[model samples]
Target: MSFRALLWALGLLVAALFAASLLIGPAGLSPSDSLAALIAGRGEAAALVMREIRLPRAILGALVGASLGLSGAALQGYLRNPLAEPGLIGVSSSAALGAVIALQTGLAGAFALALPLMALAGALIAVLILLGLAGPRGGALTLILAGIALSALAGALTSLVLNLSPNPYAAAEIVFWMMGSLTDRSFTHVWLALPLTLIGWALILPLVRGLDALTLGEDAAAALGVRLARLRVTLVVGVAACVGAGVAVAGAIGFVGLIVPHLLRPLVGARPGRLLPASALGGAALLLAADIAVRLIVPERDLKLGVLTAIVGAPLFLHLIYKTRAAQ
Candidate 1:
């Protein structure tokens, strides 16, 4: 399909999924009721459920999803590595570790906004540290190795916190919180994430031109006037803000970034600039669909979003690895 057609399809899909998210919930509000409540606050309980419960959840799904997708496309474009992603590269894990620390220390309980803030801090630290270790112009192998080490260390630290929790409840809370969900979220979560996410988007969108140039290789791109330093800084900050805020609010919803871009890349063409927006819309749709499925799949159990994505993403990731090796 043409780029315009692809975008149109993605927009329609996102819109459909967004509507599905609003209409299908435990509340069972009719489509008209959900739309009315969301738009005008017409019916009280419908308004409460739509505004306080569903609206934020849907909004976060779209916002977080778009962030993940855009970040993934950017990372892959810059690194020239298809495997580059927040979850795969340890950024999300590092951010999750930060949030876990906040939870274990009871800071999250004491301060409503502390969770995502700490998570964002953790992500910032990870980005800084990773860039320092790998250098601004590191190769794909260097980045992957550095990312592996960071992910391992962050995972260990997260485990240590859970294992050494003061009590079972603390450990349980940490464990469950890490599983990721959008349930019971409110406008507060949206406020916490949206501004940071929008800023991140602003940071990333401009890099698309650089990213397209980058496909011709770094030296060529540099010769073509893409400033390498600016590209690196922009990419790092953009991914960190989006991924950190996402982990903060949704608690480490893995694989959306990894999966969405890969699936939509062919539709949008190889240019990373084109892939960026296409992947963003695709991610929003995929995530919203997953969120809706979670409600329908196990209404009583409250299945975690991370689990569902992992179940699907892991095998697909392995297949990608296998295909990569085969190609080599």
Candidate 2:
């Protein structure tokens, strides 16, 4: 299929899934009632649920998924490594660490924006550390190794924080948040994450040509006037912003980045440039579907969004590793 056609299809799919996300929930309101509530904004409980709860959740699902998907495609393209993803690089974990610190210090309670601000800070630090370890002119292997180290260290610190927590309730809340969910989210989260996510997209969308050139190898791309170091810095910062902002509000929703790009790569003919937009749409659709399923499957238990994504993504990840090993 043509790229335009693929985009159209994915767009339609996202729209449908988005509508499903908004309409499906435990409230059991009729579709007409839900739409009416959303549009008319009556002073009723149904209207409150429709406007305040489901709308924000749906918006967040799309934005967060798009960020992860776009970030994954960009990383895989520049790094030329199919295994590259935001969470795997410690971006999400580091962001979560920042939010955790805010919560632990009671700054989040005191300040409305503390959580997201700290999360963004954490993501920036992770990227800085990654650049320091990898250095200029580092190969894909070097970058991946540095990312692995960062992930491990950040994860260890997060665990230590959990272990030493003074408040059991706060610790439990942290654990639940880390599991990742869209439950009880509001417009506040939507607003908090929107600006940074859009800025990240702006930073990344212009790099398609660079990414396309990169497939020809770094030297060839440099020969084509692609500023290799600048590209790396921009991509890393964009990933940090996108992933950090999303994780700040939604907690750590893993594997959307890892899964979406891989699934759509074949359709995009492995062109990193085309893959970026396609992955974004696919990611949004997949996440919206997952969020809807969270409501449908064991609705009483309130299944976490990350849990379902992991259930699907973990096996695919292992298979990719096996395939990579065989290719090596």
lDDT of all the models against the reference? 0.84, 0.85
**150-263 per-residue lDDT for model 1 (tens digits):** 888887788889879977765655545456788888898899787778888999988878999988888999999999998888888888888888888887777888899889
What's the TM-score of each model vs. the native?
Answer: 0.92, 0.93
lDDT of 2 by residue, 127-237 (tens): 777667656444556777777887777767776776678876655555554557888899999998898899888888789999999888778999999998899889888
User: Could you tell me how far off, in angstroms, the CA of residue 286 lies in candidate 1 after the best superposition?
Assistant: 1.0
TM-score of candidate 2 versus the correct structure, residues matched by position: 0.93
Pairs with steric clashes in candidate 1: none
Candidate number achieving the greatest TM-score relative to the actual structure: 2
Q: In model 2, which runs have C-alpha deviations exceeding 4 angstroms?
A: 131-149, 162-167
For residue 268, model 2's alpha carbon misses the true position, in angstroms, by 1.1
Which residue runs does candidate 1 get wrong by more than 4 Å? 103-114, 132-142, 162-168
